[model samples]
Target: MTGMVTQARPPRRDDGSSVQIGALVPLTRPGWIEAGHHLLAGLELAASDVNDAGGIGGRPLELVVRDTAADPQKAAAAVDELARLGVAALAGEYHSVVARAAATRADALGLPFLCSSSVLDALTDQPTDWVARLSPPQSRGWRIYADFLLGAGHSRIAVAAQPSVYWAAGTRILRDYVAPRGGTVIELDMSALTPAAVCDELAAHRATALLLLVGHPEPAVPIVTAVRRDQRLAETMIGAPAGQPEFAEWAALLGDDGAAVPFLRYLPERLTPLGEQVETALRERLAAAPSFVAYEGYDTVTVLADVLRSHGTDRARIAASWPSVAVEGTRGRIQFSRTPDISVWQWAGPPVQVVDRDPAEAEPGRFRVLHTG
Candidate 1:
């Protein structure tokens, strides 16, 4: 059921015709399945909303999901499959590696792809006119993290990055941003290290802040908890740009230690009416707190539906129309940049905010915005 593409029965569409939007997600992957499910929840809700609004050109929008399982080769193959299946546009995929691979294939096939959650800077590096992204690339997003740390007067920092291209790219960006600002960055390869080892390394460096760029919150919970227990690094400012705030059990796993750890997300301080509506609907349907990927997935589909509505299902026309089209999504307005350096053809720094969970909140994932960039 998780990987299966589900659509509302007929009568939701006019003439029983549907324009399928292809979604590439991690449905069966160990660390990514939960995120994939949340993304699907958002997509389903958005599809329903579009259908209720009479659909795109009277044809209901349908999502055809293909599981990438966080594998690059599978992601590329899925893009080909989605194109062969005659999807109007493409979206989804949580991992940057998968997104990058899929985007290339989607672009090669002349299909329009809107990346929902990948943050690798190079995902938009190519001159592929057919691809665009809703998530801010790591290059732009890491600046927000760097600025936050420098602004908070913490110059001595340590980075614990997982062995993924997503985290590696972020580590590189953070180092580039910090060194020029008279700050020092100590790097730690967290692939095979234990929580105690990670703590010892940070403590030895007298690190005032720790930047966790891990792939999941599982490692982060123990590492952060253990580091906080050390007297030397007890007050170290812990921050993660790795979508930790999106996990429903983020707080439950991290406990009180997880409090005040800032993370990068596409959401803002205040939710618009539409954002609130989506939040409420997702809560009821999923019976769990929705993650940031859910919001991104919802907005990506909304934008895709709108684009199809205005320009029909012609991929070339839709890709061409993206520049001038201003999409109002869950996270304020969505606008793609034509600039070459700034994650080319991406929603130019789409209102990313650093938020943290308040330990007192009943729902742990209900993070409050601590900083905005």
Candidate 2:
């Protein structure tokens, strides 16, 4: 029960007749618990719906949930245990590095994994068919974010980065995309500086925008507060390309200061009919509007259930079905294919948007689409 989290829904039969999918999510500290909750909600909802509609060839769809707590080693261990337990496939993980660990283990064990929300470009060192992803890669999303910054006239940008492969990759993507367009990237080492110090650096560097490549609430919230309060940095824009502000907790913690801070979200401007229905159900389930991460979670199961039905739980067959997948997800039509520089079968066209909570809105969750890519 230490690493094991809730099962989400009880199995239809106590005789162990359910089809199991090992779910890796960050449900505890150091992980973004709010995001995990949303992600799990979508996964559980989709599974419940699948069971209602004939139960994947008459066996209940079960999610054996484990809390990764945003640790890579923890994720790898969970993957190994799940593989040993004979899950047909693996799903769900929000952190990129954690998902990478899970992907690596799943590949080595020959367990098919449909990564839910992690967007790291290099999911595995070598290409493997055992793994696939539902989220857009960090490079593609972050490069779009960089374009947004440039179009908005923010040429000099500063990033307060944490020491992590995901954050480092995001920083590198921004730098690579923006440098040729007369933009400069300044890195603010969060380990060596305080939030106030970060604000001072933003002012001193004359950074028109400060992108938070750090974690939420602890440093990201404080950094936003410091920047918003500091008169010297009043003109500088605050951004979170990794989408800290996409959750309700960000607005709850930072309130007005959290507004207008642009962040990347993998949602389209208009939801499809299925997306609209899922949104309503997800809102009712979560009591808050679901982030794009929830959609990714829902889509993960949607794809896996299709594969399981067609391929009949054979691990190799499920992995092999990645290319021929053509399921209608809550988003758009979901399919997987090899993308250049990416090691897994990727959903290459998930909608990418730079959005922000409207400061003028009386409601907290109201978002304004600023840019799309």
Candidate 3:
């Protein structure tokens, strides 16, 4: 089915009612199907747990799932459909393009929307009272990456930026952070350049580290492979901040070449007690390790449940109560940040870590924390 509405559990209360939360996920999109499944897995698990624990004032949580298809128009239409169905609040969207459009629709409809994984800094740039996010925005994530590179003593860096609003925001943040510190950032737009051409530019720059803000592995795999094969650039520290969630997929495509490459992720290398619990459940359910995206999805539902529990299931009340939310999430304590430099409704300064890929570990990414902030 393209979309489905599933209740968390059988209704147990005398009223025989359930509170509906809308989820706008990219279920059928070309590059996003796997990510969509993992995210839905997390949200389903959270809903099940909440319903099992007596639900929100005895009303079981029902998630109305819609396929956004990673398109802005589809995203808006999904929100409109959810609004017509009368959901109390809305959440779940991986693509920033879709989230931005969906959030606008949700705001206009007076429904509270929580972004699951979209990272465009502009998503929450303007003061919007209806939307909030559980993931760190692109600007904050890249700034953290810059701090990690500097801490590791890499001053000269080469940037392989893909042309997308998400990567552009990250590139701007990295440039602003590095250049002011007397560090050099050589940017190569990977949009039009061939893999061989990108390698030539990297050689010319001769930087100690390569920061790839590209969201996917199409260009990253070929570029990183070419650079690693080059004897001259073998020592360069290559990092792909945007491709962390897709690490396993990229690693399979890159083979041993993917080993030792660093990437950024919100989930720390070390899982908290709660984190371990969630991982165990996810692994048991999915028959595979959960991605950071899954953790964010779970946290998103839990946060909504929190607001609904205390402030009631009123849409306006949930939006009004978001700023004051402080729930213990799978990674750690989750809270929205209002800093001017970040997405206004974003989870401010979520701890990110630079992790290296190790082939021997059980996890596909085999992520080992190299640095944390």
Q: TM-score for each prediction? A: 0.92, 0.97, 0.91
Error of 2 at 154 (Å): 0.6
- What TM-score number comes out for model 1? 0.92
- Name the candidate, 1 or 2, with the larger TM-score value: 2
Clash list (residue pairs), candidate 1: none
**Candidate 1's residue-wise lDDT over 191-234, tens digit each?**
76788998888878888888887756567778877887878776
Worst 10 residues of 1 by lDDT: 6-15
Instruction: For residues 1-373, write the lDDT of model 3, one tens digit per residue.
Output: 3678777674587777788999988788444776788888889889988998888888889899988877888889889989998999998988877888898888788889999888877774357889998877777677878888888888888888877777777778888998988788888888777777877887787789887766555667778778888887878888887744343566667777787777777786566787888899988877877888888888889999989999997788888897799998888888886867554477774667777777564655566787777
Top candidate, metric lDDT: 2
lDDT per model vs. reference: 0.80, 0.90, 0.80
| Angstrom error at residue 317, model 1 | 1.6
Task: For model 3, give the RMSD to the true fold.
Answer: 2.4
How many clashing pairs per prediction, in order? Answer: 0, 0, 0
